[model samples]
Target: MMRRLYQSLMAASRAHAQWEIETTTNIIKNRKMLIILLLMALPLIIPAMVHAASLPEAIGGKAAYGPSYFSAKMFYGSIAIGVVAGLVTGCIGAGGGFLITPALMSLGVKGILSVGTDMFHIFAKAIMGTTLHKKMGNVNVGLAVAFLVGSGLGVTGGGIINRALYNYNPVMSDFTISMIYAVLLGFLGFFALSDYFKVRKSELSKNKIGLEKLTPMAERMQSVNLAPMIQFDEKIVPGGRKISGVFVAISGAITGLLAAILGVGGGFVTFPMFVYGLGISTYTTVGTDILQIIFTAGYGAIAQYALYGYIFYTLAMGCLLGSLLGVQIGAITTKVVSQSKIKAFYAIAILAGFINRIFALPEKLSQMGYISLTPSTGAILTNIGVWVFFGLVAIFAVWIIGTFIVNVPNLRAEYDEGSKAEYNAEYGEDNKAVVSTKRGAAQ
Candidate 1:
């Protein structure tokens, strides 16, 4: 009798599922033609929508060094760059380091000072970003907390040492840290680009040849004996799996160092590390990364930007307003481009930043007389060309934003592919509550 009842329940569920499937099919059939048109139109329309957002003149004033407020152009300039930087940072799934740091450089912002300012804005933006991600139910609290505690201490220790050095000898502290940071970032960029190419070459080989391709780095990461493991509860590809604590610590430490020195949020490295290094499913990594950033970068933002007197109200506010909207559009773009494609594009964008900095070396050396800034009649022409190269970064940034808005409709079809639907469904409307529970459990 009990077995018959169980069978009857199964049959009823099958019928209901069949009915839903039939209805879904009909709806899809009717909308197929209309959907195609919408796809072609969205990419174009999104930019126009964004352009309509005009921030207050007071909020976005010029970026300058003074006791007085900034000019309007400077304000708008910073806002524009910050918004674009935030969008790209959020888009590539990396910390926005490669984008934001260079933006300050473009403005001829002084070192350490600019680093502090950029960090302040990054912290503000990260808070905004993670807040939105949480609302969508995409955050993983346990991993974020683990990352924060370990990352925080290392950053604090580094800061203490830096301050001590600067106080003892002004010349040594300022020059040494800045140069070290620049060299380190350049090195990391090369390492990151190298690995990206390796992964791509492997993929191309798999597609072109009969050879079985393997991702050895990924395999090695999985083999490590890191302890204090925790389950994400969300399945990435399929059946849920767990990840260890130690890898999380390592990724966090790297992020903190970058955050402190360069004043970047390190979201770029952190998100990829979580997804690839610690093996957290893609579903949980964004939220986890954001959560960690909120604290880690926030610390730097406060200590460096606000506490150090680099907080430009108008510039920060303009950045906040424009970036808020830009980030939304950027989030939307994730739908149109596939994850692999986005990562590739992002790697390209980062490569561009490295190229810009690398080529700027002549300008830097000449300013210090390490190289010649003096010009023959023709040398002026070469200097002009070098200045033009600097403008490539600015032009490239404009092109990215313009293209993002212009292509929205064309990529509309791809938008929903990476949506965090499971998270939204599971947590309902209370993601923070759900995350708190997870953190407590992990601890």
Candidate 2:
């Protein structure tokens, strides 16, 4: 059962990752839209850059920092984080967004700032990527609308709780955030490791690809015929599946609250919930997850974090730029590596994050006077956690880049062959010579 759950989660992650790639590609292809987005962003980014160093030390009697809050080191540091995250997302097809908050927190960023900046980054990415999915006829309008309705309320409530905690005490806020990360990462990391080991053992004997079966929970949920059933994705699944709208809303609410508090896009959680909890088809879930991310992250960032003056524009932009490049590289590298290897790395990466957060929790608890510890002990433990987290992430990044470089020749050849085949299929053998001549002339 646990193994099945792990497989389901991985499936969802891959679906979400594909959606992310498509969305990003679409935005890049549309030059006019890209220009408009940049123009809109400049107003917020420029002023933040100018006044970051001298902005007020506090807002509404709470400690706050401006967009320029980061030094040159921090700016570059954020980019590095983004690149690794994108690589993880592109290569593994999930788990990239999971790294952002933990990475930022490890770098000495404030909890609220990390959450806010992460949300802003997600919102920006969503804005650019969502158009492609809509045009591709992937989204189910009714499903998306119902999910967003619940997500909106959940995010709003979560934002309020996060702010209230921060306003009451920074120590409490940090503690709360750290605790959340520790618990979540720990749970996920455990299952991922188990799945990895299980797969390794199975591969040694069976040496075959296995199909994933839906969980009993999903079967039961799909059977429920509560009123106002949402009929969706009939094009993909004959007759489609219907469940009580309340269940969908509840799932959305859970996803939204987690997104708001953790500063993740929540697709990681959303995917599994839609599939394993609600029994939605992977195709429908991916499309809907893409649609919901825009609304959930945007509202959470603007209303919850930005309005409270917790966002760091520079950090968000730095991450945005770095991730775009990283994702491209990671996606290309995926062609070279085996699926089992990829899954192993995913498990390791998640476990590394889990350990990082778990270690950080002690210091937060000590600070809040919930536990007692010597200052030196706390500092040493914190330092150890930071080093371990970055060390693992850095190793993973290096491995991916090295693998890509070594296989570049093969990848390029594959690309050329595929391109030629596609061109031949489109223009036919008779037109191939003429097309080649025209292409060279244009060049």
User: What's each prediction's TM-score?
Assistant: 0.55, 0.85
Top-scoring candidate (lDDT): 2
Task: Encode model 1's per-residue lDDT on 81-181: one tens digit a residue.
Answer: 66665455445434334455555444444445455666676565444333343223766566676788767865665555545554554334434544554
**Evaluated with TM-score, which candidate comes out highest?**
2
lDDT against the true structure, per candidate, is 0.51, 0.78
Clashes of 1: 20
Give per-residue CA lDDT, model 2, range 102-175, as digits (tens): 88877767888899999999898887666644634767777777789889988998898888888787767877
In angstroms, what RMSD does candidate 1 have relative to the true structure?
Answer: 16.7
Candidate 1, TM-score vs. the true structure? 0.55
